[model samples]
Target: MTLTLVTGGTGHLGRDIVDRLVGDGHHVRLLARSPGARPDVEWAVGDLATGVGLSDALQDVDTVINAATYSPIARRGGVRPVDFFRSPSAVDVEGTERLLSLCQRQSIRHFLHVSIVGLDDATLPYARVKLAGERLVRASALSWSVVRAMPFYYLLDKMITSFAWLPLWPMPTTSFNPVDTSDVADHIVACAFDGIFGERTEIGGPQDISIAELGGQYRDARGLHRKILPVPMSEAKARGMGFVISRGARGRLTWADWLQHRYSVTHQAA
Candidate 1:
């Protein structure tokens, strides 16, 4: 059995990747700061930001799927000027350089990286750091593949839910193609088994929907009759905000479908 190490294995996307890799008969090892009690796979208590336990995690590993990232802006609900300048580089950029250096030393066969879409022309600091990580993977000698994915549905969920208390919800009119994290996980696992192609694969959901439209859908899903206020953006900012992958592989579920599934499951559990 091939040994694979997954960074950020406890995160939203990382959890799905770990489950799929284990189901596919690969010996999965997860790198986490505070490891969970998942009995099926081995856990290495590590922090990518400080290069802690990464070498141990890479030992005897054939493949590495890097899903680790740090986004302070997202956690704070809005971007602050302080965080906007430097936040993601700690994990996504410098940590990647550290991980790649160790992977090279460990003679790892393949390195698979997960990144966001629209890094090419994005002005956002997070996207810029992700682009730097991509560059590092490309420059490395190890056989590698980078999977650039669209914004996930849950992110949109959080974005909309943040304004749940407001009578008039503010939403950007910028158009984007958001995908389900499950679909992105499937694509990543497929890339892992497809051998090291040393290419970038972009994946997204089916429709190109505006943020305001998506907010309306969220309102309908939650039975909230709040009015949506479209916030206008400058042409340059809009261009940076909106991204559509015309030729990339599309995911199965739409935003509405994801909403229904997520809420239904929550209702059932409740």
Candidate 2:
């Protein structure tokens, strides 16, 4: 049985990954900063930003599911691009390098790094850092796999909140094929098994939709009448964010289905 250590094990995706791994009867360990205890899984108090408690976390662990992320989303509201490096990218880069060094010394069997769909060649700071981390993982002697999934549906709540006040929302026409966290966890757990693929595997939602369509779904689900007008993306934003979301292995949930089940009238029981 593979003893798996999951970084960011308390995060949105990390929780699902841990649950799935434990359900599959694997020994699961969590590497977190503090308050990492749970009912069944092992907890190692570790701060990726500072490289604390990592040795204890990795001890006797043959595999690592690195679900940790440092992106603009984690930052407080109203933070500008200039202040981004002050928070996410610097720590992201440093933490990945630290993790890689430890993995190399420990001879980890498989290292699966979770990345975004459009990050294959994205210029975005988070995407760039993830690409760098993936490169480091591949170059290392340890077996590695990079699984790229689309944005999660949870982010739509934030987007909706940002645009709720405006009668005519002016937002970038960024396209997405949002996948559910449960579906993403299922795929990642499967990839954690034997036969690791060092190459990237992409997963997205059942259908591709623009920001306007996503807004429409949220509006209709809420039973609130709202006009969602797409703002044309500037040349720079389009070229930078339109990193070409690949469609290879699509997930089962659609945006409409997810909304209906989560918030809309479709889920009478909910």
Candidates' RMSD to native? 2.6, 3.2
lDDT of 1 at 2: 84
Worst 10 residues of 1 by lDDT: 261-270
**Regions of model 2 farther than 4 Å from truth:** 74-87, 172-174, 234-239, 265-270
For 154-199, candidate 2 gives per-residue lDDT tens digits of 7666657564766776555766677888889888988888585786
lDDT of 2 at 158: 64
In candidate 2, which residue pairs clash?
A: none
* lDDT of model 2 at position 110: 87
TM-score of each: 0.92, 0.88
Over 4 Å off, model 1: 76-78, 81-83, 232-235, 265-270
lDDT of each: 0.84, 0.76
